[model samples]
Target: MVKPVNVGIVGCGAISAAYTTTIARLAGLRLTAVADLDAARARATAEANGTRALSVAELLADPDVDIVLNLTIPAAHADVALAAIAAGKDVYGEKPLATTKAEALQVLQAADTAGARLGCAPDTVLGTGVQTARWYVDNGLIGRPVAATAIMNHPGHERWHPNPDFYYTPGGGPLFDMGPYYITALITLLGPVSKVIGAASRTRSERTIVTGPRAGTTVPVTTDSHVTGILIHDSGALSTLVMSFDSAATRAPNIELHGEQATLHLPDPNHFDGEIHAHPVGGTWTSLPTRAGYQDAARGYGLADLTTTPPTQLPRTSAALALHVLDIMESLLTSTTTGQATALTTTCDRPPPVPLGPLEPRTE
Candidate 1:
């Protein structure tokens, strides 16, 4: 029997709970410690999850911690990841990788130099929904891919999130927060992006919180609330993206792929499992069976993938791919400023596909 990887988690916030839950269930991972800037919160989460509570520094240095599960906010992602890499531990974190490409590049450099494996979230792709869709495309169910569309629209996070001020900040907007899932899925299906043209709008300068104890509090909006862009994939496929926090509603499909012979309606990229429907030429839209990816996967599946990947190779949700996603997003925003199609400076090979079944113990 293989010994489970000891995971020390940093940032005991809302997302940490999901990771803790997943770690508990996945056979090859064990939650060993937890840390948060708020000691009380750290202690509470650790006690609840049957782990030790440590200061962030102590957790980083913990001898038992084989991997650092970083759930810190976007602004601190690079800092925490760098610290983990410096301590010679593999690291996985929630996405956007970092607020800016420059910072993200540094994290990538640090990991490469330290020979520490780095991975990032939006592992939702490793689940049945998107993977089944990718399988269809790869299997020629959608013949000769041409164009795609991805849309995500909502009022705003202030309606539900207690501390949503960060959502309006430079690193938070619709594109940064939600674009990763859609764009990453697109890349997985179509291939890497080469250039992009974007147009964006900030519908409101400030927003009022409508939930939690901070209800009625006003927060400044420094980033665009509505973002739309066209990604020119290296394979010559074009993906139209519409991500907006300003919209009250949208009827557009969450994601759709077009080809010479068919059109496919894909499940939401943010979810683990959902129906994938495909419409072939002169045929009715039909559902495709879950054909690829891990079954019943969850948020921390990437951490499981990271810990189990061979030391000589990167994980499917690798830092290289996350950095590429970040570059595409940052380049889109830059295009909004310059009013010209911006060419991407970074590109990554689509990581290997996940086979069906549990990621940890193989089923005979």
Candidate 2:
């Protein structure tokens, strides 16, 4: 039997709960410690998960931690990842990799120099929902991919979140916040993007908080609330993207891929699983069977998948892919400003598809 990898998590925020729960259930991973800027929160999380709570420095230095599961906010992702790599530990971090391409590049470089493996989230792709779609695409069910559309629209997060000020800030807008899921899924299904054209808008300068103690208080908007982009893939396929916080609702399927023979309506990339429907040129829509991806997967399955990967292999959620996803997003925003199509500076091969099965055999 393979030994379980030890995981030490930093950042005991809401996302940490998901990781802790996932790590507990995965046979190949063990949660050994947790840390946060808020020591009390860390202690509470540690106690809840039956793990130790240590200072960030202590957690990074601990020899028992084989991987640092970084759940820090966007601003801190690169710093935490670099520190973990410097400490000779592999890292798996939450999405976007970093707020800026430069910071993400730095983290990638540091990990390379340290010979540490680095992975990032939006691992939802590894689940059946998106992976099943990849299976069909890879099998040529779509028959010569032509184009695709990805749409994510909602009013905003302030409606429920207590302190939603960050949503209106530079790194908190819809594109940076939710675009990762859609864009990453697009890349996964279609392949890497080569160039992009973009346009964006901000509906209002200020928004009122609708719930929590901060209800009625207004937060300033510093970022675009509606972002649209045209991505030209290396395969000559084009993907249209719409990520918005300005819309009250949208009835559009989360994503759709058009090909020579049919169009595939994919489930939400934000979720682990859902129904995928296909419409042929002369036939009615039909559901595709769940044919790929980790069964009953969730947030941290990517990390678990990383633990089981051979040392010389890149995990499906490798940092290189995350960095390319980040670069695509950042470049889109830059294109919105420059009013010119932007060529991507980075790219990654499509991650290998997950075959239909559980991540590992269930223990009786």
Candidate 3:
């Protein structure tokens, strides 16, 4: 049998929980150690995940760590990932891979030079919600996908997050902060983006925290808080997307793919579970499940909870999607500022999704 991979996490922040919790429940992977600028936070996360606390240098230098998971904010992702590469460890980083495209490419290049693998997140595409949607589009359930839309909105994270200030920093705007998930999902369901145009602006210059330890504190918006963009996928499908921090919650669908014969309803980009509902050419609808709920929970929790099935998920979620989304966002911003469409260049190769399965009842 092949040995499990020993993974260390390089950031101990609010978002790290999602990664650590998932790692704790997986096989073929182990939570080897955790590192953070704040030693206490690293210790806490390390202990919680049954690992050790180390400084960034120590963690990277640890011989046992096969992969380093980078969950730092946008500004820190590239630096930490570069260090991991220098340490001869594979890396999985959270998105926007970097605040800029150049930095993202640098990280990718470093990984290549060091002979270390890189994985990035939003990886939402691997979730049943997206995989199921991909299957529908590929199978012609949604025939000749013509256009699609993906949307995400938040008033700002200050309302709930203990430290939401980063959401307003250089990399904190709606386009970078919450854009990756939906964008990655769109790319996966459709294909690589060939060109993009965007309109972006900051609705408010500053935001006040409504609730949290920092309640009443305020932060300035360093980037646009809202963005509307158009993308032309390589497959010739046009995609429109809206991301914002100024809108109140509404019933806007996460994604809707129009086709010559049918329409597809995709699930939320932030999660992996949902049914892909299809509207037939005759206007009738049917729902498809890529995997039952059991399949989703198993993958989200890591494959350890699974028993009956063979591996049904692609190993591309946690970092690969993040990197791809980072690349796409960089291109869009460049396209917007330069008033010209930009081709999203990339080298991340995700494993093909698990083979499509019978449309098992989603409720099961």
Candidate 4:
């Protein structure tokens, strides 16, 4: 029997609820504790989930905590991850890995020094949607892969999120916030990126909250609200990306990849399952059958993937992959400033594919 991995969650925020629900359903995981700077928020989450509430420091030192699920803001990701690694705990966090590559390297190095495993999010790609698409590519259904396009656009998060200040800060722009899902999916479908050229702009200097207690309150926009880039994969495939908070909307598919033989319309990388349409060179568009990945998977599946994976092997959502994704995003921004193509300094092999199966505890 595979023993359940005990989880201690740091940062009791919006994403924590989804993870909480997922942990309760997974047979190979247990939600053991919860922590936050706001003691009340942590206590409420713990009470609702039948777990103990502890201070952030206390939770990190908890002997019972096998992994620290970091739901902290991007700025605090490295600090929280490093602290957990120091305490001999594995860590998995929300995307971007850290605010900058320098800080991300520190977390990776710390995890290595302590012999602790590390992973990060955008695990939605491990679900049936992208996996089925990956299955097609791997099986040569698309023939020789050539190019891809990833697009995401929204007016702004201030229209919905209660606390929208962070979304406008350095680490919270459209590219950093939503690019992980698309970029990770693209990498999974194509391969590691070798070079990137980018252009970006911020249409608004400030934005106003349209929802919650801060309704009508304005916040500064410190990062690009619109970013476009072209990623040249090592396999010679190119992926065009458009991420924006400035657009009112877009009717474009979340992601689409073209090859010598066919064109694939992929579902949203932020979602687990959806229709995957394909149009061959000489055939009309049709929905492909799902042939891979965890069925009915959700947010915390990556943590479960980490737990069931052999210690000698890397998980599908390994920290190395997340760091590489972060490097790509950071490099794209740097390219926007330099007006020259940026070569990637970090690279990772595409994560091992997930074979089609029910979402469950694994034993091997």
Top-lDDT candidate index: 4
* Predicted candidate 1, C-alpha RMSD: 1.4
What residue runs in model 2 are displaced by over 4 Å at the alpha carbon?
A: 361-364
- Per-model TM-score, in order, reads 0.98, 0.97, 0.88, 0.99
Predicted candidate 3 versus true structure: per-residue lDDT over 138-234, tens digit per residue: 7777678899988887777878877777888877788888788788778777777767888787888888888877888888878888888998887
> Which digits, one per residue and each the tens of the lDDT, describe model 4 over residues 209-323?
9889889889999999999999999999999999999999999999999999999999889999998999999899999999999998999999999988888999999999999
User: Which stretches of candidate 3 lie above 4 Å from their native place?
Assistant: 291-294, 297-324, 345-351, 356-364
Residue lDDT tens for model 2, 1-364:
6478899999998889988999988888899999999999999999999999999999999999999999988888899999999999999999879989999999999999899999999899999999999899999898999999999999999898887887788777999999999999999999999999999999999999999888999999999999999999999999999999999999999999999999999999999999899998999999999999999999999998887777788989999899999999999999999999999999998988899999982232
Candidate 3: worst-modelled 10 consecutive residues by lDDT: 299-308
Model 4 misplaced stretches (Cα beyond 4 Å): 362-364
Clashing pairs in 3: 119-319, 119-320, 120-319, 120-320, 120-321, 121-318, 121-319, 121-321, 121-322
Name the candidate, 2 or 3, with the larger lDDT value. 2
Report each candidate's C-alpha RMSD, comma-separated, in the order given. 1.4, 1.8, 4.9, 0.9
Ranking by TM-score: 4, 1, 2, 3
Q: Kindly give the stretch of ten consecutive residues in candidate 2 with the minimal lDDT sum.
A: 355-364
